[model samples]
Target chain A: MSAALVVLRKELLDILRDRRTLLLGFLLPALLAPTLSVLVPGWTADQREQPSPVAVVGAEWGGDLVYGAQLEKLIRVVAASDPEAALRRGAVQAVIIVPPDFTAQLARGRSRIVVRYNPADQNSLFAKQKVFQAVAKFSLSVVEQRLQQRGLSRAALSPVEVHEEPIPAGGGGLVLSLLLPLLLAVWALTGASHVASDVGAGEKERGTLEALLSAPVARPALVIGKFAATLALALASTFVAGMSQTVVTALAPAAWFDAAARPALRAGAVLLLAACAFAIAAMAAAWLLALSFFARSMREANQYGVPLLLLVMIGGVAASTLEGVLSSLWLAVVPFVNVVVAMRGVLFGRVDPAALALTLAACAAYTGFGLLLAVALLRREAVIFRA
Target chain B: MKSARVLVRAERLAKRFGTFAALTDVSFEAREGEILGVLGPNGAGKTTTMRILSTLLRPTAGRAEVAGADVATSPQDARRALGVLPEAAGLYGRLTAREALRYAGRLHGLAGEDLERRIEGLSALLDLGAFIDRRCEPFSRGMKQRVALARALLRNPIVLLLDEPTAGLDVVAARTVRRALAGLRDAGKCILLSTHLMAEVERLCDRVVILGDGRVRGIGTLAELRGEGGELEEIFVRLAGAGSVV
Candidate 1:
């Protein structure tokens, strides 16, 4: 136990000296997005709403127009001289014009209207279509009213009703999917690498491992001590990051974003523990063993270790993507996959008991494998003295 | 109860690396309150013998013991009575000079009052000064060796293994390490030191073992080795050269 503490203290001190943690774990995920958030509303609002003057151009106009109150909030109608020039100058999206022939064509019920605009222009298509719909609707309403005055109850005009029902996505599952973009993953990768490479490869690299073996502590004790220190660093960082992210999500103002709800948080906590246990224990073990045997130095191990971190992250992302498509309870029993599934379930509120159980099983299996590797690596002289 | 005879005992101990024999049929003993030097050239099995005795490596053949506990069967007991400086310093590079010593001290069960006092006393003895607090990353070869010596002194164990303790040290640093070892001897600790340099062997060791080609060629006092009245190296070459030629 004392031996483990020594390893743990030494490891923690090493991690503290790294500059990458500040940016990837603490700063980027926690603070970067909200800083960029202030621009979203203004930019989107500018694209949709218009409050400018514009020219009105109509082909053979003779349509009575009626506008919805909600529609009026976005656009203003105007008749301008030289409508083409107005559009070119960015005065409006398009122009609406009534021809001099006007109501005569509507009276005869045989008049056709021509909508005119430059076909080559950027806004020409939408502008052409929306103005045309408005004019046609207004003309139909006028015809209906005229027919009503004549006491005709014929079925000439009717409005089509289209109903769209939004399928409810499982609670907040959709929101959790967005976390892939931010580097919420950097901590796990860095933590695992720091530990495995430092204790295993770093020892080999620095030529200190042989000295440690000479100590009175049992071999397993040395491994356990090293493992405990690494686990503490990994678990501490992850839990802190997880909780902080949760708080920021919970209290960071609704306009900022909605956090995972209570149920998801509960699930997330469970999955997080499962993921962390698998990642830290399994990764640390495999890493320590592999490093002890293969690398001559921490630098060499880093070269090996960094790629693994990336692979885990990439796997995490891919596994998260598989949430709806390919993931099963069995995958949850696997190491990296289990964490991803569990985290997805917790963050999204859609995971099942079977999946969580399977993931737990996988974590246990990997941990056992890790312990075996550690013992084997510790005993190998070929790995120990390569440096 | 007044006499504790053997501090280290090795019998027919051998270490083989594939087709190469690092050490063969190596056997020796250091009694309590003595400094025994195991001297050889590089790859002469000096470090290999030290490693096996220190419990860092399991011997390929036969058995050895320290403090009367067979290292093969009771490695922990051997280690409990041991303080070692591997041929390599093996100091943790990331830690400061003081922190490394303190950490080692803590592991050796030196804590609270005992730990602090041991640290300060050793620091003054080693002339560590404020350099104790500085990270060992930029330390010179001698500085690292001194810190390693301090770590070895942490427990003041019954048996001390100094492996090339002054391998790359300057004159001053070498004197410091030697002086500290002389103190340990005065305090009545068994010590076995491994070195390639004959001067270090003559300066610190009361008796020396001449090893060559993975076996001991001769063992005696410095004067006994220099019976012909020439340099110690010439005698060492004569013994090792004959072994290699044969």
Candidate 2:
């Protein structure tokens, strides 16, 4: 434990002193969520505030559907000599081209609305839905007026009742999914891996590991201590990321921008999920660092470690949102998987006790595996000192 | 003769790497208060020979013992007797000079008041008082070497393996190191140091072993090795000359 403390303090100090590492492991994840939820979606939805362009050609109903004294206030309608030409020329997005019998069919309640658009146009689907909403509202008003003229109340001629119910969530989850990459995983890697390269193969390469092996501590205890220190840094990165997310979520309007929107996360669940996330991160860190004993230099170890950290982050991201991919027991036992899946479950407010248990059990199992990896690595002849 | 007091011995010590021979059939003996300098050019297996004696590397075919324990059979015992200063000996770059020595001491089972007192005492002797609390990364080559020496000396082991101990040192720094080594020698410590500098060998060593092409060419005092060749440098060249023996 004392040896481990020596390693842990050194690793943490290395990480804390690096400004870029602080920014990546602690800063990026917290800022990513709001940017994703608010900026991206807000820009995409901005079109709703603009007046939709509609053009008519050879329509028996004229622009009455849009510019009816009652509807005129709702839509801006334009007349075009060639309605299809207007749409093709980009003069208008959608043109309501009425058929010749459209006015007679309306008297008999047999009206049709044809919306022509290029099949490959991406936004046309959304444009079509908007057109339906506006046109449908106008049709309903026409029906009500027609009914009143016939001296019949619309509600008295009603049909069967209908009701809609929401389906329960399959999994509750985390905002860490989006925010973690920038804050915790990138820059934190250097501090987290400081002792890993230096202690493992770096020692071996420099011929110093033998001096360490000469110490009285049991081999496993030594490994555990080294493993613990490395694991601590990994957990620190995850914690930094988690804290950043909490602060940003609290302050960001994207998380709670609309008065009607509420994101319900139980305080206990947040802590439970964060704890699980840290556990997985720690195990992964220990195993990955211990594995780096094979690298010949700090530079090589980092090259090996970066890809591994990336794999962990990607695994975390995939596990959080990809329950289907993570369903197998194999993935559940993978170190970073347990943390991500549990976090996802917590965020979605559908945390299953069985899944949480599975996550913890898997993390424990991987910890044992990490111990085994350390043992195997430490036992090598090269571990003492090597070329 | 104090045969029972002999601290280290090696019989036919040889280490091989595939087809290449690193150390071939080398042997020696040492007792309390003797410094054996293994003088050779770089890549002449001085480090390899020391590594075997330190129990860091397994011998291919040899018998080596430290403090009466076989390095092959009783490594833990060999470890307890050995202190190593390897080439480019690494220190935790982030740790202070004091912390570096203390940490090495603690690894050997010293701690608490004992650890603190020993660290401070070692620091004062090594002239590390000024930089005791400073991180070791920014240190000059000589400073780093002193710290390594300080760590190696902290344990007061029966055997010390110093590889290229005087390489790349400035005049003042190298003299400080030499003085510390002289003190260790005076204190009845058995040490094996490797050096490229004949001056270092002449100044500190009681016996010098010259190696060439992975084999021992001769072992003697400076005067004896230089008898026919005039000076130590001339002797080195004449002996290391490829066709001279082969």
Candidate 3:
């Protein structure tokens, strides 16, 4: 154990001193989550705050429909002789063309208002939504006017009323639940990948493996020490990412997320999330280290690492999509997927002790298996001293 | 010679990579206070023998021992008593000589003040003072060899296995290493020196073992081989099969 610790200390110091490894494994992962959290919401807010430009064709005949409503305040309405050209030139997000018989159709109590906008353009899509809402409001006001003329109640227009009630609703925290698992997995992978390859295959290529193998230290101790250093890096990255994400979520404008669905960021929940992150990091570090040892060179190790990274990403994506099935105990036994599910459960203030225990136990088992494989590989002269 | 204690002993050691034999029925011994030179041509089994003795590679047939510990069964103990300088002598380019030595010392279970003192002693012995604190990246080949030698010697093992220690060094650097090995031999350390250079063997080795095609060609003192009626070069060329090619 002591020998392992010495190796761990040496590896950690070496990795920390290397600027490239430090940047890729530690610095970048910590900064990415916070940067994205702030930038994405800020950009969304900016887009919403800007007035979308729209061209009102046949405004003379449809002046009441466009100008009478409060939509003009939110959208910039312009008169364009060639509205399609204006849209193509990016001058307008949408074009509202009123047919010459629009008033006649409205007088007959049913009018078709064609709203054309580029679906590929995000601003155009936003403008289309805004115009649709304004037209619906105008149609409602017209119906109420007709009812008043007929001396009847406005309720006659809608005989059946539909209401939507979400089950166990009122928490907008689902967005965080969906995003946190994927971020943690990414952080764990990025943190462990470079360092794992450097320590394993890098040592072999540098001709240091023979010296290390010739030492009095047992293979198990050496493997454990290396794994410890890798785990430390992985945990540090995940911790930074998780903390940054939490801080960003807390400081972000409430309008950016569902106010009702926003999870209560309690200390207990945060602690649980941190525990899950550590477990996932440990498993990932060990697994990555094992894979790296199979490589004969640093370049080869990186090549092997790419598949593990892709696996993590795929697992994260699968977990996010499978959130509805998180209650399954079987998923808690799956490696990367389990960590994501358990983290989602923790964030939503639901702590299933059996599932958490299973996930933690599974992670521990995988970590042990990975370390054993690494140690076994290290003992083989063909693997350790591969030319 | 019979009374001298044997620190490194190999009895009919053999190694094979697939069907190709790297070392076959190779046998040799190095006594304390003596340098046993392993002379071989290219692709001979000198490195294979050295690797077996260092416990880096297990012998396919036959047994080897370092400081009385069986290399195959108790590699950790054998490793503790053995110091190896490989042909490449690769160093971590980013580490200073001092740092590298400390790391090697720690791996050998030397720590704290003992590790520091060992590093200091080795630096002084190897004349590493000028560049000991600098990263190994800028060091010349000779300097890297010296650092590698210091790392191997840090544990002060009873047996030293050096493979082509002076292979790529200039004349002055090679002489420095030969002088150091002579000094170590005089200090009663057993050293196994593997190389293709006859001059190094004549200068430092008390006994020489010549290998050819993974087999032992001849083993004796220079006087014994000379008594066989040929110069050292002629005897080596004939026994190592280089004469046939010429």
lDDT of 1 by residue, B1-246 (tens): 127578888898899988899999888778777788987776788888888888777889979899988888888888889988887776666678887887777666677888888888888877787589988888888888878877787787989998888877888878888888888877888899887777777788877787888998778778898887988777888876544321
Candidate 1 lDDT (Cα, 0 to 1): 0.66
Model 1 TM-score on chain A: 0.60
lDDT of 3 by residue, A1-387 (tens): 278888888888778878877687667866788666554765676676666788988877785788754355556787677999998877898998889899998898688778899988888988888788778778888889999999987789898888977455322176677777778888888888888988898887777777777778888888888999988888888878877776777677766765545556667777778788888888988888987888888888878878777887788788856657655588888888898888877877677899998998999999899889998888777886676
C-alpha lDDT (0 to 100) for residue B64 of candidate 2: 92
Best by lDDT: 3
lDDT of 2 by residue, B110-210 (tens): 77887788777777777777788888879887788878877887877878888867666788778878887888878888888888787787789877777
Write down the TM-score of every candidate.
0.75, 0.78, 0.92
CAPRI verdict (incorrect, acceptable, medium, high) for model 2: acceptable
For every prediction, compared with the true complex, DockQ reads 0.44, 0.35, 0.67
Across all models, the iRMS values in order are: 1.7, 3.0, 1.3
lDDT tens string, model 3, B1-246?
667899999898899988999998988888999898888787888878887888878999999999999999999889999888987687877778888888888888888998898889888777889999998878888899889998888998888989878867788778878888999999989999987777777898899998999999999888886775877778888888765322
lDDT of 2 by residue, A1-387 (tens): 366565455455654565655564455544554455444444555554345566755554644664562254333466777778777776666766667777778889768868776555545445555667777777877888888999977675566666856443322223333344333444244445655665566566644565566554456766776666666656665565556555554455553333222234566876775677566656665666666666766677768777766876677566645667546455556656555556655666656777677778877777687678777766666644445
What does the lDDT come to for candidate 3? 0.82
